[model samples]
Structures are given as structure tokens and as C-alpha cells.
Target chain A: MTLQSSPRAFDPSGTEEFAHWLDGVRAWAGTAAPDMSGWRSGAALDLLALPVARGEGGAGAGFLATCRAFETAGEGAVLSGNNVLGGFLFAMSAHLWACQEPLLAFGTDEQRAAYLPDMMAGKVCGAFGATEDGAGSDVMSMRTRAVRTDTEGWCLNGVKTFVTNAPTADLFLVLARTSEHDSYGSLSAFLVPRSSPGLSVGSATEIVGPAGARTAVVRLADVTVGEQACLGGEGAGFAVLMHAMRHERAFILAPAVGLMAGMLRRTVEHARRRSQFGRPIATYDAVRERLVDAALHLAAAQDVLRATAGSADLDELDQARAALTKLHVSREFNALSNRLADVYGGYAMMPDTGIPQLIHDALASRFYSGTDDMQTKIIAEGLGL
Target chain B: MTVDDGVLTVIREAVHKAAPAFDGDDETQLITQQVLDSLAVLKVASRLENQLGVPIRDAELLPRNFASISAMRAFLATKGC
Candidate 1:
């Protein structure tokens, strides 16, 4: 049984259009099959293309609608035991935040015309190459260099780690230093194709959770591209990344919301079915309290996510709101997972029970986008402290 | 184009509030000079948006726009503030 909270309940806008779009996503996600081949399933592609403009081959849904879709997809993944589809949703959402959103916001007309159609169709996959071993939160410390060529364009050489979708990505939005100086203006973003002569993707890194996501190290050695490849101009990498992070952090926890809801659903069902001491375990104060607490945390997280996604639509979502949303939602999700584990008893440790997967994915949520510490710093600074 | 002294005053107040330790003139590079980090830049944008009643778009959050008080004024003028 699903939670009492309908998909429409999380939608703060309350428009019929958004409600209808969410319904469509729920129906599609319910029946969509998992594809472990690293390519996006057709049904998944349809959902991924929802937020793009109709002219760009999408359903013309807005940001809030897209986030709700991700949340629904997460719930569906839990019900169906399809972590592959869940991983695809996560990776594709990264594509939207890092590649699609940036292109829509800052890419030139030719760049959009060249990339958007195939990207929307899932004919090409894009990965974000920003994080490095040396520079995770310290982005300005990135050692990737893009030196100018004697002819035209520039040559890039660097290593980007933790690149999601790197194994199957046809394109990568690589951020590199254009100037030797270690400053914000020194960096630039480049859209390098996987077919580039000096570009290679390393074997996928085995992450603890999000089992199907193909993250790996991407290496570029003197990879050259034209001036047209420069996104948001020569010195705008910082701005591009900031813009992406604001939206990314705001919406990244959507799947966790769904996962928590799903975990609650399963735990409640198990409690009702599993009997102890001549009664159902759900009747006991200990089990019931855990269930109630999980529900409360889920409700609070849903509200925060809705508010943050709405702010993004209004273009008023700042770093503080985004960080707070990430911080609150992820912490609640992790906590809920632990409580549910207690309710599941020994079954929680078994692979078949699904509690272990839920716990792992929930833990992984706190680290992605930014750690809790990073979010706190952003919120504190946003307060003008 | 000339910038109004009033606009400059608002910019100065917002920057100072965002970065209480910042001590610079209108020509001082707030971004390049490292007086304001990325989060501080957002705080400045938010404060300016409230004081000037003009919304700052994400695309407009470039370092060049917040490089200095003068650059901010020039940006505001473009926004028809």
C-alpha cells in the first residue's frame, strides 16, 4: 500500500497541469522495466525529457514537475526491486542539472541547436567532470589546465574523479583552468566529446550504494577543442558551476524522499503481517513509535523539497535554501532508514529484505552534492554570518 | 553612463553587510581581490535584490558583475534599475 500522501500532495504549486504531469510520471514509472546495459530505457528517457521545452523534444514540464518525477521514480524503484532504473534516474538527473540546465541557461544558440535534441532523445549521454581527487569542495584548487593553442581553441589536460555516467557518457562538460592563477576567473568549462583523441574513461568505481550508477575517473591528455566549446565564455566556469550547484543541491534529495516513503510503506506492511506475542508487532509501542517518527520525518522532508523546488522555479533559490533543503532532507532520510532497520529486526540485514539497500542509499545521499558540513557552512554564510 | 551616488551607497552597504571585514572603495575588486567568496556573492546578490527591488537572475551572477561596486552599478543600469 502506498503512503496516504498522494504525488499531488508534494506539489506546492497545486496546478492541475503539474498534478496531471505527476500522474503521468507515476503511471510510467510503475510499468517501466529496468535496463542494466548502461543506456537509458525508453520509458526512462521519456521521463527525463519531461522538463525540456516542446521545441527541444520534451514535454515542456517545469523544474518542480521534473523533481516530482524523480521522486516518483525512486518510489517505483523501491517497489519493483529495480535499483538499475533508480541509478539511471539519479545519473540522468545529474545530466539535466550539469549539462541540460547549463546549456539552456548559458549555451549559445548554435551550441543548443547542436546538443539539445540528441541529449533529450537520450541518443547521447552527458557527464559532469568537475570534481577531482585534489578538489572536491575546494573547486578553485582544481589542477586541470586548458592551455591555448598556437592555432585556435585550447588543449585540456587533467583528471576528473567521481564522474557519474562516465562509462556510457558520449559528452562531458569538463571544467578546467584557463589561466595559471588559482582564482575564480582562471577556470573555464569545456564540452568535450568522448571521441576526442586524448580522452579516456577509467573502469567504474565500485560505490557502496546506488548500485547501478557507473561512476569513474575521466582522464584528458591534451584534449583540444574549438572556442565554441567554451561554455558561458572563457572565465565563467565558476558561475556555471554555482548555478548548477544551486539547482542540483535543491533537487538532489528528491529520490531520497521517495526512498524514505517506500521504506516506510514496506516497514508498515511488514509490521502488520509479522506477528509476535499473540499480536501484530505494529501494535507494540516500540514499533508504532518508530513508524510514526518515520512518517513525521518524511512529511517534513517532502515539504522542504517542495518549497525548495518552487523557489527554483521562481529563480529565487539561493545557496542557503538549497543547502538547508539538502541538509534537512538527507539527515531525516538517514535517520528514518535506521529506525526502519530496527523495525525490520534481523530481516533488515538480509539482502532480500531491501532494508540494507535503503540504508546504504540513504547514507550515500548525505555525501553527494555536498557533505553536511559544506551545507552548514553555506547556510551560515548565507545568513550573512 | 553615469552611476547615481545613491546606487553606489546601496551597493557599498550591501557588500559591507555581506562581508563585514571588506574595506574597499568603488574601484576595489570584490570578487578578484577575494574580498567576497562565492556564498558572500550570493548574499550580496540577495541583499541588492531586496534593496533595489530588482531580481538577480542566475546567469547574472557572473564574477564580472560583482567584481566591484562600479560593475554592480553598471549591471543594475542594464537591468533598468
Candidate 2:
């Protein structure tokens, strides 16, 4: 798995920006994983400083740039067995910026100006606190309470599960029950700062892939927030979330396109180098078919992703596009990874071969940015079925 | 035409176009295709707004609104059609 810098037509710089970023991160993950339990904190800070914005061709730089970044992350993992948490963070931050229209349409100016900068800079990580133990996809069923304090401020109370970067998060856009039970209007989004009293994060939850990608339980016990903390007005949280989701889906899937490309390249290269029956395995028809299938899937996924990203401003159309893209890319990654694992034979089962890591990373895609099942359902209900 | 009927027609068509992206042929199939997911709902809302020239507020774009053509027409009618 000697990772030579390869040129990609998609990335003119050949992912030099991301390559340098990974080198530093790999060093940290290798040398510091043991001593730095708080390494995530530093990673968070570094992630904020990284030049992954639209200005430096980073966040809000559009889907092509994001796709390149994801591809680079995939390459780093296959070649070096390094995690791409920063890639995820970069994509998420850019996503927030890319879908600013709906947020600006609904969010107050002060709220936008105050949070957008930090979020873009990565100094302040944002979490979508919509999922609960009881309500995963049914966001309307969330029970987190947001009662008004005596001082005309808001206080949030409830447990939020599966919140990424929870403990390291500087601010949380929390959805809480504002009105009453099962009432759509009752739900509201509040910006709860980590420093706020009574706002605490529980222990980090473990996932199969992205071990250091910190996901934690967020517990708010009467955590009070000022008037500015409220997003939109009473019962506008759902709208805010829907808007954010459009952005999340588009940006998140951008990287997935790249991930598959990376996997395809690796599998092809491996086949070319590994010998079987006194010749390169790449000569075999079966191996060629697998590569071709992966390439086709990658092509389809990339097409859908570009279309989705191009139509980012087209309202709900973007949502449908994002759902479609995410579904295609995630499923494609799942299938491609399995094929690569089979090609690698017993080597895939060992940590030393890097195939296992690639598989783990691919597994995360199916579950991230909402599950494939969730994406299908969105597409289905949109048809009025 | 009342504002409601026009809106309802637009909503129905958009939902119809988006529905085929899902699995079932009719509503009674009890099978959800990929098009019914959250992403598809967003597309339906967009198509409704684009085709019908009526702004369907994010809050109003719920699963119930797109339950069926008849349901959508009725919902539009009640919204000051």
C-alpha cells in the first residue's frame, strides 16, 4: 500500500491540498492516538483552520471541490489506513454555506452573521440535534423540551443521540418541543452554546468506522439561551432542519463520489500489481468486469452528484437530487468495497492489508447523512405514494 | 379559477411526476419506493412551487399534503382556494 501521489483529472492539483492535510493527520493519528484522548479537540481546531472554504477553494466551493476532497480521503484510507474525519467536517461546513438561502430566508440576520463565520471557519462545530433514541427519522416525534425561562429566554431539556462532534461542538442547533406533544408547531430550534450552564455532553458513542469521529450524547438540563438563540420563531425548527438537510445531503455525497473513485483506482492498481496463475490478476476477465462495474457505478454516482449540486438553489428539487445521489453513491460504495474485498481475498480480513479499513469506511457511508432506507422513503413519499 | 384549484392541480401533477420515482403503481400497494423519502418530498414541494406558481411553505409541505391527488386538492381548497 505504498501511496504514490497520482494525478487525477478531477483534481488539477492532484489533491495536493488534501494530501498535505492527510499527511499531518496521519502523523497525529499514528503518533498521538495513544496519548491524546483529547486529540479530537486539536483536530477540531485544525479542521477550522484548514483552507477548505470557497475562498481558498474550500467550503462552499461547490460539489466538484467536495467530490475531490472525498476522493482524496478515500485514497488516504486505502493507501495509509488513516481516518478522514476532517474530510467529513470540511464537507459539512461547506454544505452549511452552500445552502445558505433557505437558512437566510428563515434565520435572523444576527443569528446568521454570528454563527455562519465560526461554522465556516471550523472554530465552532455545529450539530443537528434532531435525532433521538425514540425518534430517528420521525423528527416530528422529538421530545426535547424548550421552555421559556422567566427572563424571556429559552431553556432546553432532553437527550440527543447520534450527534456527531457532540462533545467538541461549540454550538448546537437543538430542536426541542416548544409548543406541545406531537405538535409540529410546538417544535423549535435553539442555538445552545457549549459554555452555557446546564448544557453538558455525555460519553462518546462508539461506531464501527471513524473511531475518532466523536459522536456523543447531548444532555441539556434546563440550559437557558437568550432571545437570539432561537432560530426563526416558535415552531420554525422543522423548516430550519429541512433547509439544512438539503445542504447536508448535497455536500456529504460529494465526498462519497470521490470515495468510490479512490476505491476503484486502488482495486485496479492492486489487480495490476498482484499476480495469479503466473500473470497479473488484472488480466483476468472477472477482475476486469469488477473494475468496469465499479467504474460504471462511479460514473453514474458522479453524474447524479453534479446534477444535484448544480441545482442547489432549486428548492426541494435539490432534496430529491441529494437523496438520489446519496443513495446511489452509498450503495455503490457498499457494493464496490465488497467486490474489492473479494478481490483482495484473505488480505481484506487483516488490518495490515488496508482492505478492512476501506470496507469499514464504506460501511459508514450507507448510514451517514440519513440511511439508504431513509433516502428511498423520501424519494417515495415525494411521488405522493 | 379559484386560487385553490390551480394550486391543487399543480400540487397533484408534481406529486404524480415524483411518485413514479418510488416503487408502487398505486397507493394501496403499501410499498414505499425510493422517491417517497424526505429528499423526494422536497422535490415535490419544489415542483409544486415551480409549476403552480404558489409558494408552499416548508411547514405546509408535509406527508399528508401529498397523500394523494384528492387529498392534495382538498388541502389546497381549504387553504383559501
lDDT of each prediction vs. the true structure? 0.79, 0.60
Q: Which stretches of candidate 1 lie over 4 Å from their true place?
A: A1-39, A42-45, A55-57, B1-4, B17-23
List candidate 2 segments past 4 Å from native.
Answer: A1-60, A70-105, A313-316, B1-5, B8-47, B50-81
Judged by lDDT against the true structure, how good is candidate 2? 0.60
On TM-score, the leading prediction is: 1
**TM-score of every model versus the real structure:** 0.91, 0.73
Model 2 DockQ class = incorrect
Cα error, residue B70 of model 1, in Å, equals 1.0
TM-score, chain B, model 1, is 0.91
Per-residue lDDT of candidate 1, residues A1-385 (tens digit): 1322222223324577556656655555555553333334532335556666666656565667777778887776676666445566677777878777787788999988888877876778888899999999888899999999987898999999999889888989999988865557777889899999999999989987765567999999989999999999988888888778877788877877877777788789999999999999999999999999999989999999988887777767887889899899988988898999999899899877778877887787888777889999888866656
Model 1 — interface RMS deviation?
Answer: 2.2
Clashing pairs in 1: none
- The deviation in Å at residue A77 for candidate 2 is 5.6
